[model samples]
Target chain A: MDIKLQKVTKIFQAKDKSETVAVNALDVVIPSGKLIGLLGPSGCGKSTTLYMIAGLLEPNEGRIFFGDEDVTDLPPEERGIGLVFQNYALYPHMTVRQNIMFPLENIKVPKQEALSRAQEMADLVGIGELMDRKPKQLSGGQQQRVAIARALVKQPRVLLLDEPLSNLDARLRLQTREEIKRIQRETGITTVFVTHDQEEAMSISDQIVLMDFGVKQQVGEPQFVYDKPINLFVAKFLGTPPINLFAGEIVKNKLLLADGKKYRTETQAPEHQEDLTEDAIRAMTHEVKVPICNVEIMDKKAPDGDVVIGIRPEGFVVDEKGPLELEIFMVETIGRDTSLVVKDPFDDNKSYRIIIDSSYRVKAGDKVKFSFKPDKMFVFDKTSGDVL
Target chain B: MLEKQSNVKAWLYLAPAMLLLSVFTFYPLFNAFFLAFLRDYEFLLGSARGFTFLGNFINVINKPDFGIAMKNTAVITFVSVPIAVIVALMISVALNSIKKFQGFLQTVFFLPYVTNAIAIGMAFAFIFHSDYGLLNTMLGWVGIDPINWINLRQAGNADTSWIRAMFALLVYTIWGGLAFKIMVFLSGLQSIDKQYYDAARIDATPKRRVFSKITVPLLSPMIAYITITSFIGAFKAYRTIIGMFGESLRPPGALSKDSLITIVGLVYDSLAHADATGAISEAAAASIILFLIILAFTLIQMQVSKRRVHF
Candidate 1:
């Protein structure tokens, strides 16, 4: 079922009577019959949003609808949602079969039918052989399956998982995440899972909702969100090696990069030098020079100011006659891609990385000239950090 | 070689405890077993006429007070242990589930445990007093005639006195022991993973079933522990009755060994008459019997716990 949250807000009162807004006023529409991932770092309110949807937490200021039915005042038991906790939360005293059958027993489903349905769910989760084993006797992956079977046996409309794969070993985490995806497809339930692992969300979710400080940053298909980020935070958050940022600016109508001492300028305009307060020059450090025509600014009208440039590690292209030049200090192989750890010509303190084809004969101590792919680079306003 | 040296070091660390136990616990216990078999033993003279096969045991067993003590101990252990345990479990679970004033309520319930049991028992005596006490005055308010709870001999016949005194003793015993059991069960309840309850809530499990199927089973280990220890504690029910009925340990005006004389009380009585022939030996015999009874009960509890407790 599609779930809708409108202007939902949650506040927690601390022991000293101070109030902290855990989930600020937010609106989101989760489409039906697809797996959506809520992705964020710790304390980002993703889990809080999930609990509010499950009715375990009451939104301090708004309404929730499961499809067209308002369920804001309903208790968790009334909402047709199956929630799996991070620890798997299986009843340790019960065997796998009993754990899977507990929900049915509560709803007063017939004993024989409950038994068959539990067995079917266990089989669906590839744990049919572990029915009689207690949760403690099984491995974490097996216990997770039992918890899922227990959740699905009652046939809830929505399945919510909170970092379900976090407790598993790396190899098991990969295997079980795939297993979860397969089960979601087989059941076709509208699922929402919370995770801080960007790769996990990108690999499995049909749509990813990225959040920060209890506010939604962006929401779209994972690949779309990755290729076209809305801000610097989204760009930096979604990549593994992280997007490289440089203190650069736009001059006239072309892009100028901070390449070295040759480009260092008295950035504060002489006319504005008397007003160079800390707030005005807050993160502005200018070493901009060498305009090139190949790069494109996101918003033409917003160009011509000290700005930041975000370049994906793969955006660099080696050319003998390009504008950007850097001295490579190290070259390391990452499967088919080679990482060139080059010294940032503009800032000696930063270790700049450029990923290139491993087949290229790039070595340490090579001075390389590079050009940018306009689409792979982003220009963000220096003060507000928004894409320009 | 290093392991051997560590073993010696471990023994050195244990030496003081061993010496203390030998003086205060082990030696007395051994002497009790030694005295129980000797016939015609005298405490003051430190002499025995001769050793006889189960002579002291036969003498203690043949006493009129012995059978009464055994019956009284059985009644207190069986009646009070289950009531105390179940009541304590309910109180602890209720205490745990409330959000507000939980710490204050826990401190209130735990007050009796820290207070001396004898002091609490004396307080209970006043509460259950027949006249000019809080209980009888409350009964007067309820329009029910005040029942002579402690001094039962002033109110009824032999069987009636026995019944009334037993009722009073059971109440005092259950109340006196509840604080410790409740404290234990409360900590046990707190240690349970809250995720289990959340999962239960999501599953639409009714609160009653959640208590029976989840809370109770998860708490079985603590229940078993409390049951075993409480069984041992109830079997040693002496001071609670003394505090309620005073040092005489029976209803006022009742004949000797008639009502509320526990096994420990009977043992103390036998030990008091040390000038009499075979008195200390009989005391040793009575204690040995109480020890065997507690041992048998604890062994049975462990066996049951092995099969039932989840942990």
Candidate 2:
């Protein structure tokens, strides 16, 4: 089923009499027959948004539509939505067969038909042999499969999963994630999946809506969103080990580091040239030529502004002659890649992380020179945190 | 050396409790069984009296009131237990659906279970009185004449009979008996994972189907527990009845005594007037019979319930 949320907001009355906006003015369109992921940090509104769509929660101000019908005020049952909780929420007292058949029996399907359908769902989820066993009698993965089968038996128009694989072990998470993707593809049902894990969301979703602090940061296809994040939060949140940022100032129409390094901008100069007269521009330009000046204009080759520059861990390259010197503080070798925690002599409050091939011999207290590709450098406005 | 010391320490830790159990529980149990064959003074004075095999047992079986008391106990157990279990289950299901003030309602239902039985019996006596009672007053408003209820023996002599009205007192007893059972079933209902209901709703399952297919089957274990406990409790339903009808209704008498006399009341009558030795022995025999009946019912219920329990 297609889902549409218009001006959705959720405000929770906290214990201390404060209102916490869990979702704020969110508008989203989820097309039918596709898997969509709501991804964000722990306190973000991803799960809240999914719950609103599932009819498990009512948005404070919004209208929800499933297909052509407005179902905002409908109960969960009336909405015809299947929801799987994070804990799997299987009834421990019922056998797997009974659990799967519960929805059919509730709908008053004939006993024989309910049995056959239950068996079909069981086999589909690959837990047919365990049908007679209760939830506790099965492994976590098997119980998860039974929960999925129970949700599917109703043949609901929309399926909602809230961090369905978060309870599983690492290996099982990957396996189950793959199974979820395959099942979603096979069934071709509209599904909204919620998770704080970006990789899990990116791997399975046709479209990913990334959120932060109850606000929609960005929404796009997984690859497009990853490659071209619209803002600093999106850029930093989507990557592992996060992106590194540096403070630079605008000087002489060029970017300047605090440590007397100058960088040039490839983009057009600011349109506020009228604010800076010709004489002021000339004076600013002449200051770059003076070597003894205390002002450190960023290198003419770098992007220019008083901006925070974001560099991915993989963006840095090891160069013996590079100008940037980082004191390696720690190194974590993980077979294929090594994560290095290095101190930035230029900034006391922050550290820069760089990733290198694991084969490279690197250790703590070692000094390393690094350079990043020009295009890989992302500059953001310091105050707005918007990409500049 | 440390392992041996720990083992010794474990035994030392358990010694006090073990000693208490032996002194209070196990020793008394063995003494009761042994004394079952001896004269009363042998038990009281710890004398070495010769065993009178089946002597007391044979005398107890020959008592005329034994048959009537046994029948009364059976009737109470069979009728009261099933009714209490069914009523408790229904109340539990209703309480489960009430989202608001559920705890308050549960506490109200559970209050009677914790209240003293004598107090409930006193309260019930007033309400079930033949005249100037709440029930009779309500019946009067419905154009029914006031009739003798507690004094059913007198009622039978008059133009009207009130045996059925007297039996209505069982409903009060059942109400007080079912409070704890309802709490147990309520907990069982709450323990059910809500996902089952959600799944049922998605399938458009009707309310009745959901109750039968999911709620009833899932609550079988709790229902079984309630059944066994209620059955045991019903056989011991003497205090309330006596408190309501008073001692006159169960006068000191032989086996051809009043129809309302129960096994415990008979034992009380015999001990108060007849030979105390014979009365104690007869009480023991009656207790044994009651125990066996409860044990049989419990065993049967367990067998049937075990088949239905999902776990």
Task: Tell me, by lDDT, which candidate is best.
Answer: 1
Tens-place lDDT per residue, model 2, A236-278, is 9987778887666655556544322334334334456789988
Classify candidate 1 by CAPRI docking class. high
Error of 1 at A103 (Å): 0.4
TM-score of every prediction relative to native: 0.94, 0.85
Where is model 1 more than 4 Å wrong at Cα? A260-301, A345-349, B152-160
Chain B TM-scores across candidates: 0.95, 0.84
Q: Which candidate achieves the best TM-score against the true structure?
A: 1
Evaluated at residue A358, the lDDT of candidate 2 is 82
lDDT of 1 by residue, A299-356 (tens): 3445588778889999888877777787889999887889999876555688888998
Q: Write the per-residue lDDT of candidate 1 for residues B124-224, one digit (tens) a residue.
A: 87777777668789889989888877654254454336777788779888887888999999999999999999999999999999999999999999999
Q: What is the lDDT of candidate 1?
A: 0.87
**Span of 10 residues, lowest total lDDT, candidate 1 chain A:** A290-299
DockQ metric for all predictions = 0.82, 0.35
How big is the RMSD of model 1? 4.0
Q: What is the lDDT of every predicted structure here?
A: 0.87, 0.76
